[model samples]
Target: MSSFLTNSLKLLSGAIVAVALVTSAPALAAGGHGRKPVDPGFSFEGPFGTFDQGALQRGYKVYREVCSACHSMKLVSFRNLGQKGGPFYDPKYKNPNDNPVVKQIASEFETAEIDPDSGDEVMRKSTPSDRFPSPFKNDEAAKASNGGAIPPDLSVINKARNGHAPYIYSILIGYEPKPVGLEIPDTQHYNAYVAGSLATQWKGDPHHVPAGGVLAMPPPLTDGRVTFDDGTPSTLKQQAKDVTTFLEWAGDPHMVARKQTGFAVILFLILLGGVVYLAYRQTWKGHH
Candidate 1:
């Protein structure tokens, strides 16, 4: 009986050590952490290795002309584009300073008229303080405008949606006609990622390609609606990339600052960890 008890104790100790080794090995291998890698392809590269202002501006143009009809950017204000302080903008795009053409286009919207002190009607250009004007008078009107589907507000879309900017770009470029031998259900939408389904939640019925390949919205840019001033080919992919980048900036103007701050914090933590490790080793020098 005593021999059996001793063997059991030995086995328990070995199990504990094995469990600790298994768990601690991964921790050590990970160097105390794991982090997701940022997608580099989605990044804009210039002399500063940051977002291109020109691209963003052009993207804004595309959004206003094409996407704006279906999407509303409620969170972003016209003033944000002219902000003087933000990671995305060196000098924010604001009223008066806005491009005359862009301002003219935006001014088509009917906004509130403010009375001056003298009681004269003063029609002012829309500001950031104003809420986005709905395209339709009500939900029923909106549904009627967009077939049976409701166009979603794009204000916080970059922040709220999954797949981030890259996903948005991919979705825009991924739209294709249904292929043969695929029966998309009425409910399931077409997605390139999902297999054997049609009618996705975001788009129309799906068929072939992947599951999520079929987007409901027809290709907005089949021909050249927007030509680059630099004479770069205005491909669908380029359009998607530019617009997605703009949306990303709109979503988080401080992303660059936030990344810089995060890197600094990481470096500080690494230095602190090294110091603590050295002190711990010195204090335990007398211990085994």
Candidate 2:
């Protein structure tokens, strides 16, 4: 009985160690500890807030000129650009496609289509109804082109992280020169914000602690990389803020409407509570 108990204890210990190793793999890869993002104080943060249309529009421009080259936004459609609360929303043009801005934006891209007569694939001018086309035809192609790294879709990126707006904003502007004495693997960029995904480097190196390692994506943003039409300064900081705000808007297009509805509901509940209290007091005035 004593022998059996000893064997069981050993097995349990082994199982616990295995679970811990599996769970800690990701943390180990991302250098185990890192700084958290500070809030950028966006206009759409509070309960009564709304998205800045100008910021969203500029953000869209930044995405189109920079991020669109690598990342795919498959979930977003061209028509969404002109919808209510969107950057290109125009009260004068009820139909999104009819809006000149949407039309011009759509016309800039060439979408893949099949030719009816030859049954061959052909490129044609895109429309407001079409989605933003992928820079790569497929994942394998994207990886092949970009050193085996697949860029994530940005359509719902803001919702994916814990501190959506701030986290992404931090990552955008976080790339820095690697610290002295820190050995980063080749092709890996130093980013204080990006928690890397793989842990193969940590294997067999119990003493070689992680100090923030490789990211497949090289630092993409640089100062003066894009020209803003709104005359916003073309600095890296400004670009990052604009793009991050745009992503926030994309992820929560109905945030303003939702907040408004919530306020109305709370007001109604308060009025109803007051009326109920008055009726109860009047009815029980003599009974009490």
Q: Go through the candidates in order and give the C-alpha RMSD of each one to the true structure.
A: 8.2, 8.6
Cα-based lDDT at residue 61, candidate 1: 66
Clash list (residue pairs), candidate 2: none
Q: Taking the tens digit of each residue's C-alpha lDDT, what string does model 2 give over 169-201?
A: 888888878655455577877677665522355
Q: Write the per-residue lDDT of candidate 1 for residues 1-288, one digit (tens) a residue.
A: 999999999999999999998899777654311122223365643322456777777677677778887777777665466553322243335442354443444466655565867687665666444555556666788778776677777666666755566566656665555545556554334435322233343242332223454444566654467776667678777777778778887777666666667789999999999999999999999897
Among all windows of ten consecutive residues in candidate 2, which has the lowest summed lDDT?
Answer: 195-204
What value of lDDT does candidate 1 attain over all alpha carbons?
A: 0.61
Q: Each candidate: what lDDT?
A: 0.61, 0.83
Clashes of each: 25, 0
Model 2 stretches with alpha carbons more than 4 Å out: 1-32, 196-213, 282-288
Candidate 1 TM-score versus the reference = 0.65
In model 1, the runs with Cα more than 4 Å from the true position are 1-40, 44-49, 84-88, 91-110, 113-124, 128-133, 181-196, 199-210
Position 272, candidate 1: lDDT = 100
